[model samples]
Target: MMKKPNTAQTILSVASCKMTRAILRKTGRGGTAIPGIVAMKAAKNILAAVSEGMEIVVVTGTNGKTTSCNMIEHALTSGGHECLLNKSGANMLHGMAADLIAAADWLGKPQYPYAVLECDEAALKLVVPYIRPKVIVVTNLFSDQVDRYGGVQNVLQEIRTGVERSPESVLVLNADEPLSASLARSTPNKVVWYGLEASVGTQGNVDLADAGACPECGGEYAYDYHTYAHLGGFRCPRCGYRRKDPDVAVISVDKKGTDGSTIHLQCDGVIQKVRISLPAVYNIYNAAAAIAATKALGLPAQEAIDSLSSVQSSFGRLETFSLNGNRVQMILVKNPAGCNQAFSYVTGTGEDYSAVLCLNNRTGDGHDISWIESADYEKLCADPHLKKIYAAGDCREELYARLRKAGASEERMERVSDYHALVEQLKEEGHPVFLLPNYTSMMELRQAMTQATGNREFWE
Candidate 1:
């Protein structure tokens, strides 16, 4: 049997690994890739470091993992709890180890009072056993990274396994996801479900992320209302299984893009208004999930709401910036579900808009742009507010072809292979440019923007 590493040895191993990552991070070469590989080895080296009852919380899903995790961390800290997080958007084993290493005390102990991790679905299958978190949050399951994960069900099963294995942990789920909601029904762990409800100003029509089928009986599901995606009031027709009323719900949501909101929320009937800077109804859902998780931790509803409105996007999740006298909004789009929500947010406002859509096929971006076709491109092309579409990054031709099918004029589409060139073109135009970029493309453009303008806002 392999001997567990000692504290000094473990610290040394982590230090060495982080040093290597630091060197890579400085190279202008995609060094963030190494964290995924190094995290597992670091975990092995630090096998003896973790103790029981550590209060570790892990957040995972195709979308909202980063945003949700960020909210959790913020709330936890707001309650005066020290927490450790993989803030670099790592999610894999090596990246997780790096985060732990960075947060460790001088004595090689992780000084944070609690641990919160955002785990990639496939990575969670391997890392959960090692970490054994006290809380696991599955944000939502959708057809994400099909090239890497095969299918949504496959990733769902992997997450189910992770939650099942950690029976002692609390499972926080997106009750609207058919698979995630069903897992809550069968899992041995204590389960907490969060979802939106039908109401005025909410989506009456389902967005593409809607999973509108019964996971148990393959029966059709009914919706009282539809939020951006498959989330909202839902019930399976055959099994009569329905979306449970959420313990926490955003009762009244008022958002003005680039502006903020006064969100009225109710936690099991207690109501309060939350002041938040993040715009978009999708963010309200994100906030609702965070509030639910905090309530699960036993904090008062008002406390969660107070902290939630103060939280900001960690990076490229609805982060806004001023660039070339224009308000630039960056929304990360990796899967069809997320892409659809993004498209809806931009087009629904009925404001004339121009956008720079960046795509990349790197391992981080999943090498499969085919899912872009599955997105609701018709929302963009048919919207009278949309003026121009500039496609950049890998597979621009494919993206152009797909957008064309949805009514985008061939004359309005401009393809640019370089990030710098795209930014220059964006600067020449004075309209708000909604930048939709996948993982790697976001980072590439982030670096270019940082170099040219000394601002991280363009990528944030």
Candidate 2:
């Protein structure tokens, strides 16, 4: 049970936060985190107070956090449960505080029965201590925001800290990810592992693996097969750490196309054919994660699988739009692995599409442009269906240089610095447009495209 605050300070804090949010919204500012910051500063225990009596699920990882959270939220809502979420992609402590405060009344009482939070990996340590979620879903870990996280080990430690704090929370982990699977050994929390079974096919050869060395013994791990980016059937020769059988496994893939996929999902010995509306192997992993999470919440596996069939791409991830009679698909790429996935998706579509690569070196997007080299840009350039490539964003020059180095033809390359101009140019292109943007650049591109198309703003 949540401890209600009877103090006048608590009341004043909640009132001030609410008022600030309202004022910001009215003034055409999307102040997503300010209210929570103000509330937390005014009353330190505000999140705890409001989060009481709600079943909270915290989703955190290097990638797929947003999509996974969206899937879980969709499942919960479709199952007739009112849920709260930080929909503005605010996953930090201040942002989370703001979200919870916004969902509560003036007295910091929650109106919803559930809160599905997309949490930043570092922010997990801060949030889990206070909210103590009923379930913590770790999608997977990879090198991301290198300037902020320093290294993948640091990220693992941060998530481990959060897990340790929430001893009672059920953990939905990825068995194929050695780092994620290792978390089960550290914390006393009950863990439910989910991953692709061997029948789904092996990951293609890549020059690098994020988790090449075993976390347990610091020895090079061997793999029976790989899905992508160091996720698959792995075994540490030195420490005997091996992949565990998943509670929710993808037993077979019936069909995989540009639109979606059909797979056989086996949960607790029961198998069912599930359709994932989103394309890509990464999304299949996301579907497995969502199914495991829903099961952890005591929801039927079929309910979650059904919700996945209708799950639309969240925010800028594989979001499609019809602009001026031309199709535009926006995919958010923050790291090499994610970028490679997008590249594969675009080229595999078998359509002649114009591609826009937006790069930004803002702090939010790690300043390390070097990771772009790891993406299979050469393969993307080799695709004959990729008609033309447009470079945009603050780091357009860098992107152009990278494209050239990747063997992209100079005749087909152009630079569009202004997002509005880029959108206009894309509108004129007769073929479909695939836009890939980094973190900050994604927000800018989405805003420009949405404003021109009259689509609802992200905050809405």
Candidate 3:
């Protein structure tokens, strides 16, 4: 429980958040995380104070949090319900605090009845208790930012710690992911499950052979099929710990490459054919997650499923735009799981396109670029439809070496170090261009590309 802050502390906290955000915007900086940091420094319980009485749903995990939150928010808004959401991809404690404070009144009380907060997996414990959300959604976990979180098991424990902190918050878990599904056993919280029942594909260069094991017993898992990565139907021979029958499940999927996918979804014994505008098998999981979460939050299943067809949340991941008279899709790849999915989706599409692979070893992108070796770059390089592979970023040499080793021909590959030069080369491409960049490199290249194309800033 948070201490009862004095009236002065409450006022100061709210003012601090609002003012800091304003200054950040004026100074041409991102106000997402800083304002929350400033506000929390002013009042420790300010987040709880403002969020009190507001119904909330907190989304966390290594992937799909933002998309799931966006879908839930879209469903809520489609039903004429206004809600607060942290849609700027700031899932940390401070970023969430800033969002809440900005939405609350001057006295530190929320002005709305609901909120959909995307909390980072590691930051989940920090924000979950204060919000005590109505629902907590955990998308599948993978090895992301290995230096900061250590490993996948460590990331799982961090999320489990967060979920354990607030047992009153109902959990919406990916039933197919044994690692994330194990949370249901540790916590007393009610679990709402979602995942794909069948594999969209099983072909890839990545080795996930040792990835999913029984969390209860030190036993290996046998999968009936895989939707993506290590997620699918799995049963442990020793402990009998296995995948749960999901409350909302993707019964089947008809993928349309980058255009989108049509999924047959099952909700409360009723099957609904839903069309998702987002591409890839990972997005099918994201859709299932959204439907499960919104349904748990009391929205009609039809409304929740219907809302996804119109949600255009490609704020970076698989976002496409016209640049230099070419159609360029920007997909952010930070971890092997995400990178493999991106590669599989593109290569599987059979589309004639060129690719620009951007690699950066900054803190946000994780200082380890060696993880690219784990990603299935072979699938991407082997695509006969690939007109060329232009390696760009600070680590372009490393990317060039990696792709060359993955069967990319010497004559077909090029290395462009400068962003300006990369943009110019993209102008000459007749085929659709696929731009895959890590976190920091995405930010850097996006600035140049968006400027050249007259697109709005990421924050806008």
lDDT of each: 0.72, 0.85, 0.83
Q: Model 3 over residues 1-460: C-alpha lDDT tens digits?
A: 4554677998999999999998998988763688998898999888888889888999988877777788788888877778888766777888889988989989988888889988888899888777788899998888888888898888888988988888888899999887889899889999889988787766474355436577788799887886677777888878887899999988888655677889888888988788998888888888888888887787777777888888776467778789867788888888888898888878877779998889999877788788888888888887899989889888999999999999999999998878876787788888898889988899888887887787777776
Residues 1-460 of candidate 1: C-alpha lDDT, one tens digit per residue: 1244675666666666667666766764332546435544554646235322456878888788888888888888888887776777766766676666656653446677777788888777666666677778888878888888788878888888877777877888776566677777678888777765545363323654447367678887777766666766778777888887777766666554555556676677777767776776667767777777776676665565778767887777887666677777888998878887788778766567897788888887887778887787877787777789988887777888888898899888889888887777777777787888888888877766656556653212
lDDT of 3: 0.83
Question: Each model's RMSD to truth, in Å?
Answer: 2.9, 1.7, 1.6
Angstrom error at residue 451, model 1: 2.9
Candidate 2 clash pair list = 36-98, 203-226
What is the Å distance of residue 100 in model 1 from its true position?
A: 1.0
lDDT, residue 98, model 1 = 61
> What TM-score fits each model?
0.91, 0.96, 0.96
